[model samples]
Target: MNRKPSTIPVPVLMMIGIVAISFSSIFIKWSAAPASIQGMYRLLFTSLLMLPFARPYSGALFALRKKDWIMLIASGIMLALHFLLWMGSLKFTSVASSTMIMALEPVFIMLGAYFLFKEKTAVSALLGMGIAIAGVIFIGWGDIGISANNLKGDILSIGGTAAVAVHMLIGQKVVVRMPSYLYSLIVFISASFVFAIYNLLMGIPFFDYPPREWGIFMLLAVVPTVFGHILFNWLLQFVSATTVSMNILGEPVGASILAYLLLGEQLTGLQWTGSLLVMCGLAAYLYAGRKKGKDIAPVLDNAS
Candidate 1:
């Protein structure tokens, strides 16, 4: 007799994804490769690793309707663009600033849901988001400045955040119909293709990287790209896009702590305070979400 497969709880999976993605910044910082180059290999390797697993779902992929195909391809392009812009932002701005700015993804997602889906948001959730945004501002207060280059980086990060928000919102609709692994495989493959073309256009060499850099690339693929992002894609089937994006706000806190421990980066008193506020606000938001009932209700409640 065949036994059934064991399933992990959604909350547990989300926590694991958060922890896994938190290391993405640290890995990027440790590598000496150019941002696009690092992003290219990371997606390329992730696609390769996912190939064997996705093969079983070949029929599912082939059965996709034209609309499904369009959404998947668009989502994949946005994902690639998000990585490119975010990685580029890291070159000119501090990690704290980049990550903090990227955390604005939820705001974009909320706005998209409102305009595209006619969704409303709860007042409590809005308050929580405000608190979290304030906390992120506090954490990055010192790093933000009026410099031209820094402003450019900030703009890039904001663009990346918008791209990713669009990706997730699309996934929220598509993933409900497609199997998680199959959906992720298609998106990853598409992103890898985009990255490959980008590398070729820029004349960036994919091979001949140092052994250490290759190792970092592999870690990024296996840990963050696969485990972290794929898990979020899977969770999108159960939760609203806004909820998933809000949870991602924890990345800066996790990345900051890792930077402190691994990279010897020091945090300020305000940063510490801000970290606590973020945690508290996130918890409040999630709690309010659960209490509201329905995956969409938390984000769809009237603002009042």
Candidate 2:
């Protein structure tokens, strides 16, 4: 007998995902490893952790259509690029600048949706997005500089933003048909393989790191990779890609707070105001989404 799959509330999952991912920047900052090496370990560890749950759905994996595999592969590669470029940017720029630039991903996602899906965005949603972006800019006001290195970092962060936007756009289309666990496992494995190859080609060692670095790698996998990204992937089955991307705007607020508390990075008065603006923008965005009849309740109820 066929049975419907049980589901969690999408909003709850999104909140958890946001909180989990907010820790990602902090984790990256704490690690002493190369960006590629850290990325490889993060994805590799996540793939291993997901293997057990994913094994139960092995039959479904073989049953995926060719087009699905293509999308998954592309999404996985893009995901790898997003991490590599964004992490690399962190090496050259302030976390505030890097994260604020990366926050522009929703703009790319919205553009892709309009061109590919013929999706029309609401005015209120657009306003909310603008406000959120403005808030991030304000938060990063003093941090962003025009030096050559900062320019390079900004470009890399923008590249990462584009990569993730494409990944999420593909995910929205594919996750509707693929089981979340199976989808996550395949994508994680694909990214891990790509990063592993990149690390090897760049002469980045896969091992011999200190125990603290290993622990940081493991935390990266468990917190940001597993709970953060995997949860977002699951939510893609319910929410629009733009919505998912917009939710990520919350990351800057959380990341800023975490940086201040843990890393002793002080926040300025302008940054505090910007943080409030970000929260307001997010609330308006979600409220506007609901007003436009884009609630996830029906989607959750219909999931099988």
TM-score of every prediction relative to native: 0.79, 0.79
TM-score between candidate 2 and the true structure: 0.79
What is the lDDT of every predicted structure here?
0.71, 0.72
Looking at model 1, residue 216 earns an lDDT score of 95
Report the number of clashing residue pairs per model. Answer: 0, 0
The list of candidate 1 runs beyond 4 A from truth reads 1-18, 145-152, 226-250, 269-277, 296-304
* Model 1 clashes, total count: 0
Candidate 1 residue-wise lDDT, 82-176, digit = tens: 88888888676656666766765656777788899998877887787777677766655544533557656767777888888888788889987
lDDT by residue (tens digit), candidate 2, 64-111: 999998898898898889888998887766566667666656556777
Candidate 1, residue 81: how far the Cα is off, in Å: 1.2
Give per-residue lDDT, candidate 1, residue 201.
94
User: Which candidate number has the best lDDT?
Assistant: 2
| Superposition error at 167 for model 2 (Å) | 0.4
